[model samples]
Target: MWTTGAEQVEQAVAECVELLGAVTGRDWEGVRAGRLEWSCRRTAVHIAEDLIAYAGQLAGREQESYAPFELVLEEGAGNADALRVIGTTGALLAAAVRTTPREVRAFHPYPFRSANREGFAAMGVAEVLLHTHDVAEGLGLAYEPAPGLCDFVLTRIFPHVRPGESPWRTLLWATGRGELPGRPPVAGWRWSNNLVLGTERLTLQGVTPAAAADLAAVGDGGFAWIEGGPVEGTRVGAGLVHQQYEDGVHLPEWGMYVLVRREDGRAIGAMGFHGVPDAQGRVEVGYDLVEGARGRGHATEALVALSRWALDRPQVRTVVANVERGNTPSQNVLARAGFARVAEDPGHLAYELREPGEG
Candidate 1:
């Protein structure tokens, strides 16, 4: 069955191909002109070649085919052939999806099975959509995505959906879009992709208060946004690492927390908050995880637990939060956890929530 959601991949691909037709072959000059230090030849050929390679990979075909084609491009594959090859190949991949059951198995980049045409179609669509933008941008034509494609692509890829992180923000994390908050580089600990905790494939082992101090120390010279205050990397002497403190003068009430998550516990990544409570008797909450830990609702689950704990206190009545305005991903997180938007600031906007109380 073809749900509108299911056809997202196709829509992205078709738009890419159509946009390619609007530009002339010579438009590649613009591509070359604006090329990154890494890439060249922005045209149908460039887009097409990558599409074919992606299609073949998803189809469970040998990577050798894609490899040689990529090499040919690097060796200066002619624009004409590149265009023809990519266009034909991309079309064929789409056609296969139209005529086949998405669940048919095939070799994917990851070890898992394509197991269906849908998976292949999804991969193919991603390839075409991405390359199409590359070529379009190279040719100096404006590139706007189909209304919902970016959202569609992001939700498919990112695993962690947290309160401060939006689908766009998550997309940035997944695609390596933005710079990460810098931390002092730990000498003995192994570094994962973006998160700074000890890496044992999803566990937070060996993160002592001292190690947290070291991490904040690493950030001192490198991480500009995060100032190293008294608590920047203070070791609380227990298993806990108080990486950051929630304060106005020491550190702004916004944009920081006490990093939490047991190195070996089921939870992958989380943070704890400790600023003053708001009128509603609640405090702010925020956290994010490594890309691998998303989609399991760990964020919501963790926040709920934290809220319950906060509400248990007699002094607190409401929690206050300030998500980056327009960040839907984090907004969704706050919404899912029952926090509602109450006010706005010039830079960071605010949210409010009354703790669970007995009437």
Candidate 2:
């Protein structure tokens, strides 16, 4: 996914340059970029600005606010010069994406405060594709990016939007550039990054669809793990998340999360919900740790943070977990996390945590 993303930066820039080069003699400053209030020239510069900024984030591993510099063009620059800048910045972003480790997330102030390499790539591609369309619309030129590019961005970033038959059209609609038949007009929007939760010593990183795919295929899901870590259960959980993405019903915030130790960035375990919250505001939870990392209360710590996060949401009133009958350690972890034994089946015991005021 990372390789494809970087390759796409090159392709998208090439297409945009070719399309806009055909009309360099025209007055870009006088024409508005599609529905945006900014002129076509300004929009073109915005594209270059975003590309370079994303590159800086990845290259610098910016964790908090944005990097403290902007990409301002030289004096006497024209549409042609802007296009050249776009090409250069696009290449820079591609290089950054290629070199940045998959687990490295940087500042991207969308709904979430950070984004991984794939997320940055998808956002970069979207910027190139959409702005090119806007410039083309203003210049009276035709523009349509590849369907696969649109699909890549949609699946990676716009997880909440229902897909349409046409990926380009759907992507255009997602960014408020066009329309889909069944959906309402989007007047306000924010691209969602994967949610990250911090505990006293760990950060629970949400697994994206791309990461989930890699994890399901016996990959590390881009995490550095503890000894004998990312056990079988993590792989199985990743498979389920990947399947949910394929089915287009995966709520990104409800998917699996890897618990990474803050001191060393080594992943200790995985934990998450079975699915989205039910109508009755109930959801199932599960967790597992590496054999060497067991009995250290990592699971208990993660469960408490995750359970609190879940119950704090309006749609979740209870979180439940099912443990094998003989797994005393697991049961103890749940008890430590404030989950009461709720019920028992033939082979397992059910534990639950209700919102304090509810019961």
Candidate 3:
């Protein structure tokens, strides 16, 4: 799955070209009638423009948030200039991806910019796969994606699918289907009711360092006499402390914070948490620790602390964590932290803990 930028660029360019060729071979009437909705002509133009816009963003030329679609839609379909824009964008993207550094900062479709090469490639792949299908289907042609590319699309786009939702339905929903599932309904965009996609629950929470005690306690790994150990302010194993901030920085929105300390004042280890939150005031909990700090009872202490902090607030009533199947170390840690094993997911496990006072 580790691919070079040059390789990705070639793949993306080829996919775009194929879509254009497919469009040329198709008739345009039924498409114009909403049978497939817009004609293959509109489909090709959209693909080309999308590629050009992405390229411009990568090159730091145009702001990524500029919506060429809405602009073209307002400008009326079949505008010759749109094709030129599309052609230019595709070329630019193909060139940039091969040469840009992974860490280079560039604006993305949202108001913000991405800070690395992976983000850009991900954005590119998403566009090529999504629009290629759009053109193929609009022209009434059967187009099969390369196996690897489809897998990549599934990873990026499938997590957006909720239980009981069809991936096909989700695709339609994503591409302006009825009320878009798995995403907040945008005012102007009607989601497609035919695909399998819906909003998923990802209750997250934010807590201060002192409040993470319940999560920290589980790191003890069965060793006694090491309660309340010093939190590692630096790396002890694969996990980073303060000094290793960069390594974990990529996980900006999601990652764990640790607390460590022993009764004897030596640092035992740390723990982590992962949860989802919304306006409804609910959050789940997750925790982890490094190898050396295991068996010292630190994880239990941290869990208690974090749990107490979360429960005291009117907002949070439950915390949840998932462990891999057969990962006894993690399952044991969760148990010691007061979480009861609840269920299994594919190859992992799930546990839940109610706030101390919750019934």
The most accurate candidate by lDDT is 2
- Quote model 1's TM-score: 0.39
lDDT of 1 by residue, 170-245 (tens): 3333343332244222223211111122222321222212223334454221111222222322222211223231
TM-score of each: 0.39, 0.88, 0.45
Q: Candidate 3: where is the Cα deviation over 4 Å?
A: 4-6, 19-30, 33-37, 61-88, 109-116, 162-272, 277-359
* Local accuracy of candidate 3 as per-residue lDDT tens digits, 10-97: 5765755655553453454346522336665665565665665556566663434543433244354443344445555656676776
| 10 residues in a row with least lDDT, candidate 1 | 245-254
Q: In model 1, state the lDDT of residue 99.
A: 61
Per-model RMSD to reference: 18.3, 2.7, 13.7
lDDT of each: 0.45, 0.88, 0.47
Clashes of each: 29, 0, 71
Q: In candidate 3, what residue range of length 10 has the lowest lDDT sum?
A: 190-199
Off by over 4 Å in 2: 1-4, 60-64, 101-103, 224-229
How do the candidates rank by TM-score, highest first? 2, 3, 1
